[model samples]
Target chain A: MSTAERTAVTATRTRGLRRILRPRARLWLGTLAAALILFVVAPAALSGYQFGLLAQFLCYAMVAVGIGLAWGQGGMLTLGQGLFFGIGGYAMAMHLQLDDAGPGGVPAFMSLYGSGTVPAWWEPFRDPWITIGTIILLPAALAALLGYAIFARRVRGAYFAILSQALVAAFAILLIGQQASTGGSTGLSNFRGFFGYSLADPLNQRLLFFLAAGTLIGMVLLVRLLMRSRYGELLVATRDQEMRVRFLGYNPALVKTVAFVVSSVFAAVGGALFVPIAGIISPSDVAVVPSIMFVAGVAIGGRATLLGPVLGSLALSWVGAQLQDNYPSVWSYFQGALFVLVLGFLPQGFATLGGVLRRRKGDSR
Target chain B: MTTTRPLALEVTGLRVEFDGFVAVRDVDLTVPAGELRFLIGPNGAGKTTVIDALTGLVRGTGTARFDGHELLGRPVHRLVRAGIGRTFQTASVFEGHTVLQNLDIAAGLHRRPTTLLRRRRGVPEEVLRALDTVGLDDLADRPAGELAHGQKQWLEIGMLLVQDARLLLLDEPVAGMSGEERAATGELLRRISRDRTVVVVEHDMEFLRNYADTVTVMHRGSILAEGGVDEVQSDPRVIEVYLGAPLDAPTATATARATGRETR
Candidate 1:
């Protein structure tokens, strides 16, 4: 063969190989479908309660992906996704409670917190669509306001991190202090039905699981589309060099704010789905500790890679759940050790393992 | 390719001070469209300072108007948008992008908002035309970081070409180029001057003599002389500055004066 022909052959082979191995949307969707069928449908076939728990874990993974986008890709170091998550959970929880209690009827937690009468603020949640809409809009609006204030003033790095953490801290404190309006320390729980269907029924439980799975899959696709767009390049450029991007005729603050708002919306949606599957809404669920745990999973996966966040979140959550069952008290220490190990030895995360192995193979060849 | 237009750039009473020391003091200059002006001076003579002030990189207490728009206090991107493009002393190409991408970005200047809403299109034909001018079209796919020094210099010029600015500010465009590369760059500048105003700051006297339609000499934060290359070269003050001698006499005359004094 001529030199051109040899080059063409190599190009063809590479193209074919890429087609076979590239992580296309269909491939990922198919994989997710298969996993849903196996973990959710199969478990629903065998045991209903176990399926519900797995769905809850999937919700956590969805929030982890949001953390990855904000902290990992955009370099915002957000330790307050839990606040948005909680907003979503509470929005959905309020709506469910209202649906259960009917108009003017007080929820179980409202009487425990001290009021025999339903609050006016909880009245709007009587509309299921309004409550669901708030789940997506409330957190995004808050993020937009917060991100605008912080990024517009050029506050970034550890300062932004601290500010975000403070938001979550304040949120948890407010939830604990507001006993009359909110449930205070003991959250709104013991839900019975969602839109006239029994949440405890096996079919209803499976349906909730499917919804959570579908939401996660949808969020992943949305993020993938965003990352492949021109805005995505600007986002990455903002992370790498803000000044250069500014000189390149882009407003870095605006770009970062949009990404942060989008990430917050993702977290809210995840938290919204989390309520029905987990069957609880509390200050503890949206506290500072859980917020940090969300970031830890993304860091261990790889911030810049797509699948890294999802798999890392799922694996870490699974391990945490397993260890909690096996050792109970010692699991927290082991989790901390895992983070330190990953940070020290594999700072690039497990996603880069394939690249490392490829380099070794090239050297041998 | 030429028009009898007014000045493309005009600077009046340009003053730049850094930390209480005056770097460029009360300098005045102008370059008409389609004219090639050389800013020639010794080290620390504030030539680069004048260019930086013109490009909005340095704050100067003077009026710099580009096509009648005030340039001072405007940000760098705004200046670029106002039809003034510049090449740095050290090339500042985006290293991650391909050669074509760099040119494409330059071509996209002021035309499209660099947002996700804008679609990425095929490399504009003007980009290839620019590469052809710089003779880098063959390497369009290669990363800019991997180019040779001369190639990078040419690539920077190609970027400026695609920007199609009315005024081009170049700092030492041939600083590190080989002799052949220098000659090609001089030719390139002469050709580009057919349609745009070019203000070049260069220390290479030969390159300036070959390409500059007019040369301005700077000394101690001021314009010392302004004329054609031969006129500025033979100016007594320019000679004194270049030779590092006193303002009055040649070395031979000075030596003879000293001997006569010693004999007396």
Candidate 2:
């Protein structure tokens, strides 16, 4: 071969080698940076109030992680994550409420709103262990059952999205109507403690922040594990060509259901943490509007990537908080404009910005 | 060796209906093990539908027993699990995945739930073998969407091969292929069918004449003719209803009716 031909071959090989190596290295680096920032940097820099806000955002970020898996990777397009989040928050919130009320004492809201007695359904959550278990298990069971029914029947795309939205809407309405049992429209709030730690203490507040941070990291690791596994490839295969996967002696329904269950668990855990961080869980929080917001964050962040949902939700939550606190009324308009522009221009989200620019450069050649 | 290998596909009283219209009515067919059987007909001849019925894609009321397992009543995945695998006319593959990943996913019937959660340690022996068989080993890392039309069709075949299916049903495997790709696919088909029973639902008469061990002709749902390639080609019923028409010529009766039948 000529020297130029040899040089060209080496260059091509080098580029191919780099293509294989870069993504894995970048993934590890990005994960480490996220860990350092979340566990160390953020806590040190922000004040307790600001840190609490970040903690709340992390809960949403956790929910977004599942969305990234289900909607982004699995092509589920789950829009009712708020329902699971609400379930988790309510599960945790009820336990705390019971703890606050103490032995045999009904919560103040029940006596004031309706009957002076707790419902039979509210009885199990009095045990903290049961409450925690309920937070995880309920969403898993619900998502599995719901996902199987929908997927097995081959109801997908817009129909699935609409069904999810309707379910969340119904959940919100059910909570609101159950005034005596579920604290009515105000929902559950004013927690004195989490597990045993006093909520008012600054140290414990920081501990809660750490818990949120640790849990978010754990969830990311869990997602990374799923995305790398053989099931991950199957999930993507099911997403892109479901019937093809079905014809390969694998049930697409089962694969889809697994992702949905995991997504719900993530949202539920985030919601459970939100109870302590935000100090409230209401019907408005778990309704159609908030459910759509979770999807919006995933869409803006780039659902397909692991960190996209986490970073996207954090950005949206932070920006929304700033606007709500300062601009108030105009925040929605500005947020709407931003949403329209991002989806219009970068439909894959900000995660694909690097790729988009590189593509445009290639176009010039 | 011929007696040692069992029968692959046996159908009796197979009938399929959509609404009130019958697509395939009372068709019975069988192929001995390891036979490269071809099902050829003009459009709406129910050639693809017969494969679809056997594979459990469409709800067909009949008994299709493959490798001693009943196929007709089971779901698509269950039939696949029962050692039956099929491909589509418009090559179905995971567009985003690499060729290796596509094969790896297909070669996952025996993968336990626990092992599924871990990343692939290295290339599996079966996936590599399939890649070599499909002539896609060099392009293993390339995204399936980036492959040529012939390559995509080959990849689809490779997927079924990795699946280790006993009964392989291929629908129009070489549609729109250049002469070179067509010849290569015919050779590949012959290689893959040495042990496994392969049923090719094809249109290209040239391909069937060259490679098919046996041919089953369908016209208007039921079987028109069935025999060895040269024998079936000369059959008057097959020529009158099917082979006599220009290969690309769409019949008025077929075109005006059943446009939606091909999609499912």
Q: Best by DockQ, which number?
A: 2
Which number leads on lDDT? 2
lDDT of each: 0.79, 0.88
What's the TM for model 1? 0.80
lDDT for each residue of candidate 2 in A1-365, tens digit (9 for 90 to 100): 98545655665565676687786796677678888998889988998778999999999999999999999888988888899999999999999998899978788888898779888999888898999899999999999999999999999988999999999999999999998889878999999988888999989988898899989988998999899889999998998999899999999999999999999999999999999889899999999989989988889999888778888999999999999999899998998998899899899997776666556556777
TM-score of 2: 0.93
TM-scores for candidates 1 onward, in order? 0.80, 0.93
Model 2 chain B — which ten-residue stretch has the worst lDDT? B251-260
Question: By DockQ thresholds, what CAPRI class is model 2?
Answer: medium
- Across A1-365, the per-residue lDDT of candidate 1 in tens digits comes to 98545655665565577677765755666667856775556564745555666787789888887877776677788888999999998898888887888777788777866757778788889998899789988888998998988997789999998889999999999999987777888877788898788987877887787777777877777777777665665566578656545445445688789889988988888888888778888999999998988888888888777767877887888789879999999999999999998878668676665555455556777
